[model samples]
Every structure is written in structure tokens, then in C-alpha cells.
Target: MYHALLLLVQKLSYEVEEQIFSEVSLAIQKPESYFEMFKDRLDERGIDSPIDELAWISLVDSLLDHGLAFEIDWKESGLYICDVVDELLDRKNMACVSWEDFEDGEFDELPTSLCLNKISGKLKEQAISLASLDIESDCYVLITVPSSDTDEMKALAKEAGYSIQDSF
Candidate 1:
């Protein structure tokens, strides 16, 4: 099972994170339940019922593709709920950085590449992009990386002047 460490840097506020989760949950839940409602209709049509699970999973996968959901680690078990969020920060200028973007085909040396300087550079780049949008709000760099890289990620984040806000 693969897991991701959600590093919310810059503006560290639980309220913002919780609000994002709440809004996203409500948004996805509506469509998810709508799909679930089809089970009864299928049953009435003499088809195998209880397709709720599959339907819900499909809807969630679609949401993930559209950046409406974030993946977080769930110990060693592969079964886990994806983290849903409406936004990473209150500002519209926030940037999201995924660990996959840093991969250079050398899986063995991937961790070594996630160093302080590189991570900080990425953050700076994101900040600059936000600035161009006339956004003076605190810049945030959210990273979604595997659980195995949590510790190293934390260390690098600290070195990059970002405090660890939350991890799942």
C-alpha cells in the first residue's frame, strides 16, 4: 500500500484545513450518495443490488483526478479513505507539489534528491508564482509524498523555513 505525507507549509491553521475537508466532504458526499441511491433502482430492475461501494469508489477516484481529494497514509493497510479538501489554503494562490514531480527515473536516489535546498527552491518558485497573481497572502507549499519519506520530508521542510502543520 502506498501512503502520502501531506505537508501544509506557510499558513499553518487547522481551521483552514478543517474547512477545506468539510466543504469537500459535503461536495463529494452529495454525488456519492446519489450514486448509492441507484442500488435500490437496480434491485427493482431485478439486477444484482448493493453496488454502492463500487459506485462510491468510482466517484471518489474521479474527484481525486480533479484535485478535489488528497491521499494520506493509513498505516500498513492498503484500505483507507482519501483525504478530501476544497482548498489547501484560504488564498487562491497556493501551490501544490507532488513528490512524483521530483523523480528522475532513479528510484534509489529519489530520497537523496528531496533535500533542503531543492525543497526550498520549489517553495520559492511557488511563492513567486503566487506573487504574480497579486496575492500577498502567506505562501503555502503542500507536498504529497509516500509515508517512507515522512521523516526526511519533515527535516527538509524545517530547513526550508516551513513548520510541519499536519501529517496523515
Candidate 2:
């Protein structure tokens, strides 16, 4: 499943370069809305179904690869739907990953920005994969990845110049 998600992201990155795919921002901002809009356009209609819990979780993780996922704390008083966009688009705390903004990749080389999602409480390193990217402005997104420990990840994030909280 993780591999599949990685492939999807990589494919989407190429699609972006080719101008054949829709922008990542819209997809991350309103996944359900967009799904409803394009549900009929899909060739494999039988495989289409409402996103399940597992699917949403994985989708959120994939959004990170595009550097578009934001962590939300819904327990706060009087949370509203608008708050979701506010929390995610806030430039102060967001971590932007751009493949071109960092360095070019050779064959077998990893892109500077990568994404990994963990299920349960365990983080698996092999779940990580790089995005295939080109173009300078294509670098405007935030992403999350797997780490062994919360403290260690936090330290790494700090070193990388992002204000991300430790993921335990």
C-alpha cells in the first residue's frame, strides 16, 4: 500500500510537469469535494467508492509527500471547518519541500523532499520514497516523513529549518 502511494505521488509529480495532472493544492484542500467532481470521469467506475478510514489516513500521509498535509488539533474549543485551512496554510509553521529548490537528482538518487506514513504506532523506514520533480516554482509544499523517535525527528526538523512538532 505504501509503495502504491509512493508511485501515485511520483506519477502525479510527472503529471504536474507535463501539465497533465491537476494541481496538488486543490487535491489536498478538498479531496472529498474533488473526488465527487471527478468520480464520473474515472474509467474504472467499479473501483470508485467513498474514502474509508484507512484510505483517508493513507491519503493524508500522501498529501505530505506533496508538502501539503497539515496536522490539526480538533479538540480545541469551537473548532470550525475554516480552521482546517488556516492551520494548514499558515506559512510560519509549515515545512516546504521542493526538489528543484534543493538539488537535482541523478538516477537512483533520492529527491530532497520525501514522504512516509505510519500506521498504528510503528514507523517503518522503508515506507519512505522521493518525489520526482522539475521546475523551480514546483517546490511550494510541506511534507512529513517517518522517524524513529519523536525527539530525534524534532531535532531533525529543527536542523532542516522547520518548526514541526515531534511525532511520537
Candidate 3:
């Protein structure tokens, strides 16, 4: 049930997130029926569902006024309902990909060779690309390197036809 809610909230749309947040804000006020509406919604989606497990959201030991975060093994990346929303609304260079779009399996490869950057260590540090929740507007995908490497990432993104967004 928690997993289903996680996947649903990972909807990642600003509008949807706002709706969920509004619903949560109201539901949290009730304390007892916090997840009742969520369960009903999930059950409705269970008919001919993509995956199994018609999860009954029982045992609400505590209130989840802030919403639940689930780290599922189904996908290698952890899905955060809030982080994705924040970056999408505030960041200009970032793109939002829906779970359904992912299911379609359409993809393109960037010029990854440009990711090879020789930072201070003089070691060839490779910046990888992925569908990430913890993302920034500086460049597409998650660049896990020092601040110095951001220039290289921006260069790579621009060279790859990705625009450097001045404002969102």
C-alpha cells in the first residue's frame, strides 16, 4: 500500500503534487482517515492493474501529514514526491519524465564522451546520466562531482544541444 502510494505520488506533476498536497493537508487534519481516500483511489486503479497487490492500507499507527516516502527496489532510483516537484517548478534545465513514458521504453543517448572531465585529481571523472529525483537546473541528469566540475557539465550539456536556462 505504501509502495502504491509512493508510485502514485511520484506522479511528479506540479498540478498533481499540489492536489495531493491539498488532499493531504485536509486528510491530516482528520488524523484517523488520513489514508482512506488514498486507499480508495489505489483500489480503483487496481482493476487490470499493471502489477499485482491490491494493497489494503491498514494500520495507521501514526499520522503522515507530510506524505510517505518509499525506497522501492523495482526501480534503481529512489522516488521522492516532493523533491521532483520542487526541482521541476524551480529548475529550468530539468525535464520531467512520467512513469508511463518510462514504460514506453523510448530513450536517447547523449554525447556521454564529453562527460570525461579531468578535475583537480587529474583523474578521468565520468558524469553519468539518469532519471533522477535529486537533480539541479545546472545540467541534465545527476552530476556527482565537485563544484568545479559543474562548468564542464554545463559545457557538455550546451554542446549536446541542451540550453542553459537563465530563469525558470
Residue-wise lDDT of candidate 3 within 22-79, one digit each (tens)? 4534443553344454555435434232222222111111111222211112222222
Once superposed on the true structure, which residue ranges of model 1 sit more than 4 Å away at CA? 1-11, 14-93, 96-101, 112-117, 128-168
Model 3 whole-model lDDT (C-alpha atoms): 0.29
lDDT of 2 at 65: 36
Better of 1 and 2 by TM-score: 1
For candidate 2, the per-residue lDDT at 49 reads 44
Scored against the true structure, residue 158 in model 1 reaches a CA lDDT of 51
The better-scoring model by TM-score among 1 and 3 is 3
lDDT of 2 by residue, 46-139 (tens): 3264443223233333444344444333231212212332333342242322223212223113222221111111122333221111112223
* TM-score of every prediction relative to native: 0.22, 0.21, 0.23
* Candidate 1 lDDT tens digits, 61-80: 33233343333322211111
Candidate number that wins on TM-score, 2 or 3: 3
Ranking by lDDT: 1, 2, 3
lDDT, residue 38, candidate 2: 48
Best by TM-score: 3
